[model samples]
Target: MADTALPGTRVKVPFAGQAVDGFVLARIAESEHPGRLQPLRRAVSAEPVLAPEIAELVGDVAARYAGTRSDVLRLAVPARHATTEKADSVPAGTVPPPDLAAWSTYEGSAALAGLAAGESPRLVWTVGPGDDGIELLADAAVATASAGRGALVCLPDVRDVARLDKALVQRLGKGRHVVLTADAGPAKRYAAFLAVARGAVRIVIGTRAAAFAPVHDLGLVAIWDDGDDLYAEPRAPYPHTREVLLLRAQRAETAVLLAAHARSVEAEYLVRSAWATSVALPRDEVRRRAAVSVTGDSDLDLARDPRARSSRLPKEVFEVLREALTVGPVLVQTPRAGYATRLACESCRTPASCPACHGPLRIGAAQAPPSCTWCGTVATGWSCPECGGRGLRAPVLGDRRTAEELGRAFPSIPVQTSSAERIIDRVRARPGIVVATPGAEPPAEGGYAAVVLLDTWLLLARSDLRAEEEALRRWLNAAALVGSTADRPGRVVAVGDPARGSLQALVRWDPAGFAQREIAERQEAHLPPASRVATLTGPAELLEGALAVLQLPAGAEVLGPVEVGDGSEEQRYVVRVPRTAGAQLSAALVALQASRSARKEQHLRVDVDPVTLG
Candidate 1:
C-alpha cells in the first residue's frame, strides 16, 4: 500500500474515518524494540478534535471490540461543530421548577441526590419508559457537578441529545454549557473538545460517542435509556455507550446513573454483583396488571388483506380507531422509521426480491406487480409463482399509511402524522389525530381518544435481546401521549392483546417494573448488563477461515455458524465470544492478519456488546 500520510504534516493520524496527514506535536524516545516504527512528524491542527482522554477511550473501545480504534473515534467526534466556546469553568446543579412541583420528584432524583450528597458512589436506576427520566437524570447530573464536580451525560443518539439539550436549556440556562453531537460540524467540535479538556464546560451532553467527554473531578456519568439500540455504535470498535460510561465512571471514581425506562441485563449484573446499586419503582406501580384485550397476529391477518381497506380501512381497527377519535385524538404508532418495515409476496411467503440484485423490494403500487426498487425488476403481477395464487407479502406499514387510513376511517376528523418529518416539539402540549412513529409521538390532542399500535409484532420481532424492553419503551411512548406527561393521571387503550404488550404498565402507569423483569431475563440469558457477548461479522468464508484460527479463552465458547450477511452462502458468520474471551478472541482473530489473512478473504466487523443477537 502507498505510504499513508495526512495532508499538511508528516503526523498522519486517523481523522474522521480515513487516515489523513497532520503534524504530530509529540514524540518520545524509542521503545526497546519495534516494527513499523515511523518517526513522528508535526502538523497544523490549530486544534485537535479529540482530547487525550477521549482518544484513550477510543483505544480502549478498540481493544474491547477487537477492531480498529480509528472507527470508534469517528463515531464519538462530530463531523463538524457549529461553534465552540473557549474554556470557562463554572459550577451548576439541579434547578427544580419554581413550584418544586413535580421537578424534585423526577424518577432519577433520589439516585442523584445520594450521589451528590456523597452517600452513594454509584447508582443504577431502571425506570419505566417515558418517565421523562432522562430529564430527571440531567437534573441530577447538573447537581453532581454543581457541587464542585464534573459531569458527563451520554445518550444513545443525537435525537436524544437534542431533547436533553432543550430540557437543559430550560433548566441550566443556555450559556455556560457545551453540546457535542455528530450532527455538528468539525472546527466547532474541536473547539468544544478544547472546552471540555481545558475545563471550560464542566457539564457535557453528548451522544454515545460522548462517553469520552473529558471533565476533571467528574462526579457523575449518566446514560439515558440503556436499552436503546441507538446507544450501540454501529461502526468498528462497536462499543455500547453504557459500557463506555461504566468504564469511565469506574476510572473517574464518579457515580454513574443509568436512568433508563428499563434496566439492561448488563446493568443488572452491576447491581447483582454489587458493582452498583439498583433503584427502581415497585412492580405493581410500573406495570399494567389489569386484564386487557389483545389484537395480534389474528388482527394483522385481517389488515394485510388487500380487500380490507377497500371502503374505509379494516373494519375492526377502523371502528375502534373511529370511536376513539371522537373522544379526543387517536394515537397511532408504527415502527420508529416511517416506512422501514417491508412487505413480501403472500403466495411464496417470501419478501419480493429485486429483479437484479435480489435485494428486498418495497411496495409501490396498490395491487400492482411489486418491482424491486434496487433493480426495477417486476415480480409476477400480484401472483405468487410458487403457489399460483395472488396475495401480498408482508406490507410494510409506516405512519404515513396509518394516518391516511385514519383519515379515511374517520373522514370528519383531521389526522396529522407526527415523526421526524412532522415533529411535535412539546408532546405534552397538543391534541389531534396524531399518527406518530415511536420516539416522535405527539402528546394527545386531549390525551389520545385511544392509542392504536399499528404493528405490535414488529416490536417483538426485533433480533435484539432487548426486544421486549424496546416494545415497552414504545408502549410507554404511546401510553404517554394518552396519559398525562406532566404528572396528571390518565388512561391509554392499546390495539393488541393487552396481554402481549405492557398494558399493565399503561393501566398502572408503571415503567419501572417492566424494566426490572426485562433486566432479569437479560441477566439470565447472559446478555449485556449481565455477561458480555461480542459479534464478529464479515464475509462468511473469511469469518470461518478466521474462526478456524481463532483461539478464545478456556472459559469462553463459540455459539454459532449463525447467518450474517448474504454476500455469498458463507459470506457472513455470527461468532459469539464471551466477555472474558472477547478481548482475547478478537485479538487473536486480528492477529491472524499478521500475514494479512483477511485482506483477500473477507471484510472484518466486530460488534462488542451487540444489542441485536441476529
Candidate 2:
C-alpha cells in the first residue's frame, strides 16, 4: 500500500504500447494481490489534479448522472500543458463594483445583495426580455469580488461567453478575471486553468466546461439561459450546466443564481420548493421592457387577404415592418433556413420525396429546383410515390423564401439573410429587413425597431417536452433586440394563435407566470422538472437483463423498451421516479452500472435527467 499512490493523484502506468498518464484511484497493498503488479512508472503532477472537495464532487456527479468518475474528470481538469507551469501572479484591481441599488430594484434582488455580502443565498431570477444577461452576471461577480471570494459564471455557448467576457473585463479589470472555453487554443485554455488553480483570478466566466473550473474560495456560481440545449453536453455521462452548478452550490455552500429572460420549468421548481428565492421585475417593469402583441392569421379579414398563405406577408405585419424599417433595421424570425424546407404532393397530400433516392425534397432558393435533402440529387424527374403527382407544394416555408417574398413586397428595400451557413453577428444601421432563423438573429446597430416572429406554429409543433418554453425563449430573445422603454418603445408581433399559453404570456410580458403554469402542468402530468427521469440505451437483451435486476426505488416506473437506431441493433427505455426518490434512483442505477462494468458486460448508456425525453 505504501508503494502505491493515493486517489486523486496523477501517475504513469503501462498502456497499449508505452506508459500513459493516469490518475491513481486507490492504494493497492502488495499482499492483497498474489500476481506481480506493474510498478508505477512515475508521478505526473506535483500537485493533485483533483482537490479533495473536487474529488468528492466528481463522485457525486458520477452517482447523479449514472456516469463514471473518468467522465466527470474529463471536464474537471484539462490536459497537461508545459506552458501552464509558469507561475502567474494575481493582478491588482480596484474598479467600482456595479451599483447594488440597481440590482435591488428588481422585486426580490435583496437576497442576491446578501449573497454578494458573503451570505449564502440561492436565487432564480428572470431579467425582463431584452435585458443584458452580462450586466446581471457582472453585478454578481463584482459583489463576490468585493467580498474577497471568487465567482463563476457560465453561459451556454462561445457567443455568450464573448458577450459576458467583454462586460466582465470592463467592470472587473482585465487582470482580475480569466476566460475559459473549449474553443480556446490549448495554451490559452491551460493558462486560464492555471490562473484559477493558482487563485490569481477572482472572476471565472466561460461556456459549459467552465462550470467545473477549480476556482478558490468560491462564493458564487451563476448560470445564464439554463434552458438552452447548448448547456447539455453531447458526450457520455452528460452533465447539464444548470445541474452542475446546483450541485456545486450545495457542496461548496456558495451563493447560487439561475437567471434567464424566459425561465425554465426546472428553475421554477427550485422557486416553488423554496430552495431558492425568485427574483423578477414587477408586471409594470415587464410591460415597460417588452411591449408584445399577437397578430393571429385566423381573423376572417386576414384569411381572405392572400393567395399564398404560407409566404404571404400579412398587411398588418407589412405595415409594422414598413414603419420599423423607416426608423431602423427590422428583424424577421423564421424557424427554418432553406427556401422551402418541406414539400408535399399537391394531388394526394402525401409528403414529397425524391424518386431517385426517396429522400425529403427541399429547395435552396425560390428559383432553385426541388432537390433531395439527403442525397442532394435534383428531383427534376421525380413523381409522388403515393399518387404519381407531378407537381410539389411547399407546406412549410423557410427564411430564404420569406426574405424573397418580403423583398418583392417592399421593392427598393435591401434584404439580408442569416442562418446556419452564413451568420452575420451584427446588422448594419440601415433601413432594411434582416431575415434570420432562430438563434441566428443578428444584433442591430442601435437595437431593432421591431421584430416580427413568423411561423410560430413550427416551433410549437415539436414533440419535445420543452417545445412551448423553447419557442417563447426564441421569440423573446429576438424581440429583446428591439429597444424597450416608454421614451423609445419597441414592439414585437407574433404571427400565430393568440390563444396559446406561450403567446398570451408574451403578450402580457409575463415569462415567470408562464413558467409557473408550465411547472404546474408538468407536476400534474408526472413529467420532468416535477419528477426525475432516466434513459437507458443499449442492446435489447442487455437492456432487459439490466432492467430486471435494477432495484428501483419505490414508485419508480419504466416507460418503454422501444426500438431505436438502425434495425441491425440497439434499443432504449426510459425510467421515471418521484423527485423525492431521485437520490435512490440514481444510486440504484450507479450500482447497476458498476456491476455491468465488473462483469465486462456489453455496454449500455444511462443518462439521468436528460434534456429531452423523446
Candidate 3:
C-alpha cells in the first residue's frame, strides 16, 4: 500500500471502523503506534490531485486563519471525476506575445515586463476610468504564458469571470486557458481542475476558489476588486481571497497584481509597507478623464436651491441627467434593491416592526404588504410599537422604487432596472435611464453618459467600521463605468454632503488619497490594517473557556464577551493585537481550537480581520 499510494495520492482508509476518504501527506519509514496499523482500505485514484505547492499553501492558510488543514484542503481541491482523470491530456497551445502598449499609460508597465522575464514584481494597481481591466489582466496572463510560465486570475464573481474569460479567449486563443468556477457544474469544474493539474493549461481564471488553482510553474496571480464581499469566504476560517493569494505569492515567488477601481485599506497597506508597488494614472490624466461633482458642496449653491437637501433628486441632478441622456445611457445608482426596503409610521415617524419576531419590516413591491426582512413573515394590520399610528411611509427608496419614479418623470424614455433578482450585463449606448443597486450597475456599450449616485448618506450611515471606505469603493466602481475624454470628460454627480471625505474623494478621483487617510485614522483607532483582530463567537461558557485557555501574546487586548444572537446563550469576543504580534495571536488561537477539539468541545467560529465589526 505504501508503494502504491504516494504523498498527495487519494486513498480510502479505515477510521473508527468506517472507511473514509483521505490524502497521503507523507510516507514514514516506521510507525510509532504501539498497536499494528490497519491496512489501507483502497486507493481512490493514482492521480495526485494535491500538488506539493498547493498542499503547502493549504497548511499556511490554515495556520494564518487558525483553521484545520482538512478544511483548507476542501477549498484548495475539487472533488474527483473518474472519467475526466482517465481522459487524454490536452496539449498546450502557442501563446503570442502580448501587446504591452495598453500598459504604457501606467508607471507600472515595468512590472509586466519583469513578470514576462521571470521576475516576481508585486503591484497594487488602481485601474483608470473607462479602462477595460479585464483586458489588462489578460495581457498580463499572455505575457506570463509567453515565457512558458503559468498565471492565475481570481475575480469576485461569475460575471467578472465571464468577462475575463471572453478577453482571454480573444487574446490567448482556444485551449490555452481554462476557467474554474463553481457555476460550471461538478464534471466541468473537475475537468478544468484536472487540466491545470496535468499542465494542459498554463493560464487559469475564475472566482474566489480559483486562488488555489495548481497552475504549473506559476509566475503571476492577479486578483480584481478585492474589496468585494464575495472575495471573503463565508465558511469556517473565513479566509479572504486577497490574503490567500498574497500567501501563495510569498511562498512561490510569483508576481501578484491587486487591481481595483477603488483602493482598499489592506491594499494600501501593502504599498505603504514596501511589500508592493502602487500603479495608478497621473493626477492630470485622472482629471482629464473624470468630471465629478458633489451636491451641497457650498452654502451659496445650497441656498440657491433650498430643496436640494430634502429632495431625492435635486434640480441640479436632474439637469445633469437630462443633458447626458440626450447623448447616451445614464446610470442611476441606488443603495438598495427592492421597492421599499425599510418602512416607518407616517404619523409618528416610528419604525415599523414585525410583531411575530420583532424584526424590521419592509415592502418588496409597489403597494405590497409589509414583510419582515429577517424571517420573511408577512405583517397584516401591523401597527407601530412606539406609536398608535397604523399608516406606513417609505423613507428609503430602493432601485425598484427609484426606477418607477424615474419612469414617470421621463415618460418618453426607457428605464431599465438591475438588481440581485435580475441583472442586466450590458445595455446599449443609446439614450435611456438605467437604475441599479450598488455592484449591480451594468456597463453600456461605449460607456454611460453620466452616473448619478443617489442616497449616498445611506451608505455612509452604516454601523460598521469600514462604512466610509465601503461607500467610496461602491461609488468609485459605479463612476468608473462612465465614458470620458480630454475634450469631453465623463460626468459623475453624487447627492450627499460635499464636506464628507468620501464624497470629496469621489469628486477629486483620489481613491488612493482617501485610502491613505483612512489607514491613518484606523491606525489612531487601532483598527485592522494597523493591527490584527480576531473574533470568537459561540455560547457564553464556551467563549469564556476558550479565552481562559488562550495564551495570548503580549500587548494583546480582549475587548468583549458581549451578548449576541437571539438569545443570551450566544456571545462574541473580540481579540486584538499589534501588527507585529499577529503570528503569535494566530498561533495561540490555533492551540486553543486544537485543545477544544481534543476534548470534544463545541467549537467557536473564528474570523480574523473580518470585513465588518457591526
Candidate 2, superposed: residue stretches over 4 Å from native: 1-9, 13-20, 24-39, 87-95, 100-105, 300-312, 386-388, 485-488, 565-568
Candidate 1 matches the true fold with a TM-score of 0.76
Q: Which candidate do you rate higher for TM-score, 1 or 2?
A: 2
Query: Highest lDDT: which candidate?
Result: 3
TM-score per prediction, in order, is: 0.76, 0.92, 0.95
Task: For residue 397, give model 2's deviation from the true position in Å.
Answer: 2.4
lDDT of 3 by residue, 404-519 (tens): 99998889899999988899999997999999999888989988899999999999999889899999999999999999745898899999899999999999888889999999
Candidate 3 local Cα displacement, residue 524, angstroms: 1.7
* Per-candidate local distance difference test: 0.60, 0.82, 0.89
Residue pairs that clash (backbone atoms under 3 angstroms), model 3:
none
Better of 1 and 2 by lDDT: 2
Model 3 CA lDDT for position 294: 87
**On a 0 to 100 scale, what is the lDDT of residue 488 in model 3?**
90
What lDDT would candidate 2 get against the real structure? 0.82
Give RMSD (Å) of candidate 3 vs. truth.
2.1
Q: Clashes in model 2: which pairs?
A: none
